[model samples]
Target: MTTKRCTMPFLRACAALAGVALIAGCASAPEGAAPKNSNGWVKDEVSDSYVFAYPLVLMDVSREAATGNAPGQAASNTLRNAQSLPPVGASSPPEPNLDTLVSTGWLDLGNEPVLISLPDTHGRYMDARALDMWTNVLWSTATPANERVNGLKAQTIAFVPAGWKGTLPARVKRIDVSTRYAWFIARIQTRGGADLNAVRRLQRGLRVAPLAAWDAHGKRAAQAEAQSGAGLSGDPVETGAPAARVAALDANGYFNRLALALEDNAPVPDDQHALKILGDIGVHPGDGAQLPSGSKDMAMVNAGLADGRTRVATPPSNLLAGNGWLWIGDDAGNYGPDYSLRAYAAWASPGLPTSRDEVRARVAQDSDGHALNGANRYVIHFSAKQLPPVRGFWSITAYTTDGALDGDAPVRIAFGDRNGARRNRDGSIDVHVSAERARGGSNWVPAPKGDFRLVLRMYAPKPQATDGSWQPAAVERQ
Candidate 1:
């Protein structure tokens, strides 16, 4: 017979009845005293609790980094638009998209609602989304649940606090957000370097402002010119990227940050039990300023930290894996009870859009399930009947195992419909992958001379692609 897993509600009830004294002892006991719980139990709880809090902590640190340290017009309620595509081989952001230019900003809803104004895309492909501090997608143009009439249409939106009643412009739609902080990201299609100017024009048309100023009609000269990045106050977070900085934080630093973040980004109902368990280890919200000082307790904390990092680095079971490929879909961007999957997604792609907007699949092995090496030539043959199905488009990009484009590659690092890859007479497409140019470079995707991987992205994918009714062909050694 299978054993049932211990549910959080049961754990909470047990803690209330018998574990309260033990928890108080754990919290107030001297560092050198024997641990209130067994070493293994403490280690497991610490790791699990850390994973539960990872997304919020990461999101908070990322906001500080982006709004304070990033260049351009990055600031609270102001956008930092990318003037060009990410440089080839840039490793700062893993798996950068080559199809669109990005614009990002943060919102502060503690005082008032923020207004976002968007211009029409005129049939061009564009997507925008807003995520709460817990990394839950509060609103997305591409998510069917949002009921956006036209994701690319000219529109205005007001992101208001959960209980705030406000008067917005007659045409502005109001979206209630539960957190005091939110993140907004927008992407506009760009064909290539030559097409950047057009995308920039659209980017310039986007605007963000405070709802009060907008209602007053003056708009404070557009919120004092939208609080130019130059006027940004406060010392930025440490110099490194947010993810790296978060990883480097110590036990006290990390847990304290989480405690402070919870003041604004309150936990959802499902997180109550997890929060209670965290208190047993003295990790209560607003009270994680100090960690246990005993050597034995510190060792358990450190081990738990290392274990949590490893668990998040490993792929979660929810990913759709097949034919040597792994991917995520509709389940991403809105995880409710799956904290492991949520942390994994946040670590993998901090600003990932909903699967309805895009689906990304990666493969590091060939048809034989061997690690892909650039020394061997390969081909991904898509039969005419099996071509990727998408409403927007699809592309396959080659990257080093470390997730960087090959700097030494002579030909393009990616190939797809946009490249107008040559097709066979049977209407099938054969995408050649090799270190050397293949078939005179027609539909050729260059690879590094060592280990490599491939990423397949389908934007606005059709139902078949996400439902597993359709799958990309395996990569065969040539």
Candidate 2:
């Protein structure tokens, strides 16, 4: 197989956002640069920082608005799929049904609280939590448990299964305490004699409901993020200090500004800004009425989200500032699954030179229900001269389909330039990932029972590396 490798020094140079040289390397203004604009007045430290930060803030906000739908869920976007466990063999035992128990189902209690019901798959609903290909969580059991299923009487309730097909006590429902942004999937055991359809129905019925609408156009969002260059998805312009001050001001007062700026709907009134409505989120005078028999944690989260929505008609200034910063800063959190196989800690961004199609992709699954088949191996690839673009450190690791240490991993190791990984006569590094051991495998990491993933980590990276000017090479199967 043809594998493109990256070198260390090249990657190192890429770290500092050296790409700026590719644009224009004008030196910073000497100690006293000309005034920023028509105002001709020098900006104070805070104001200057904010002034330089405004375009970045706008960039960040626009990019965030884009994630409402992006390649994150696309089949060709393999970065996320790799993080989950692939299915086990056909004869593998039932691990978990992602569509059920852990689907993040949500139901509005309306202005008031509501009671929710779930079926027991086994005595235990969820045995272990496995991240799905979508980075969604799935719960599985080996044998079903049938203990006290007191779902209602308790303030916090959830079904904990012993194993697959374990029975649940006659009437047990988990009640969770209240909180905002709380997510829980109560596992329920299924009876042995029950038909497969019944179990399937249980799986189908489970889900997160009454949620925010899914963001529809991910590509468009990504495009916007790419142009800004500041946040995980934007362009960074060279504004002077005044811009930085604007960002600080936005942060200091407009925590909710981002929420507003990135709104899928029309612009909000400045006086009725998003921050004005966000200040009261998750705050309660106190729990006046106690939930005697219900899921306390679940209820708390539900109420908190609701309260934030109702009390705060606008958003918070701090959140707004954060949003602005994120938009232009070119920083975004990696939320989707990574298959734990990212050979390095480094991640792929939307704006890399490599086509999204060439990076990563996923398949249906393994018996374990995680994603193992990577349409492209080494989701992030670099060559001998193009090692990771980092300021500090870099390494690549292998992960089993379940995101656990691969029991079958060769030497159970990760490879990195710092670790003495032998280089080829041509000066390229070979990182082998598979179920079998590579002869003299210096960087062999174990693969779990099912599919696996790889990660490449770059600690303390330079701007170009994180900003997506330099892209990693792809992994080729031997």
Model 1 residue runs over 4 Å out of place are 1-37, 69-73, 143-151, 216-224, 227-240, 411-413
Give the per-residue Cα lDDT of candidate 2 at 128: 22
On a 0 to 100 scale, what is the lDDT of residue 407 in model 2?
41
Task: Name the top TM-score candidate.
Answer: 1
- For 1-478, candidate 2 gives per-residue lDDT tens digits of 2212224344333322321221111234334433334121111122222221222233333233322334322111111111112222211111121111112222222222222233343422322222111112222221121122222111112323212233222343332222111122233222223332454444443322221111232111222211111111101111122222323432323223433322322211321212222222211122122211235433433433333222222221111021011111121222111111110111112111111001221122322333544332222224667665544345555554433444433343445655566677776766655455556755654445455555444433445543334555544443
Q: Count the backbone clashes (under 3 Å) in each candidate.
A: 0, 175
Clashing pairs in 1: none
In model 2, which runs have C-alpha deviations exceeding 4 angstroms?
1-381, 407-410
Q: What TM-score do all the candidates reach, one by one? A: 0.86, 0.29
Each model's RMSD to truth, in Å? 6.6, 21.8
lDDT of 1 by residue, 1-478 (tens): 1112224355334324322222223345434444555565556566776787888999999887777544632668877676766565655566666777777788999899998888788777788889998888888787552223234777888899989976767777789999899998887877776777788788888888777667544232444445333222111121226778888887778889988898788888756767775775677666655555578878988887788878767786556666778776556677766777678878877776777777888899999889999999999999999888877778888888877777777644458887777889999999998989887769888888899989998877777665555667889998
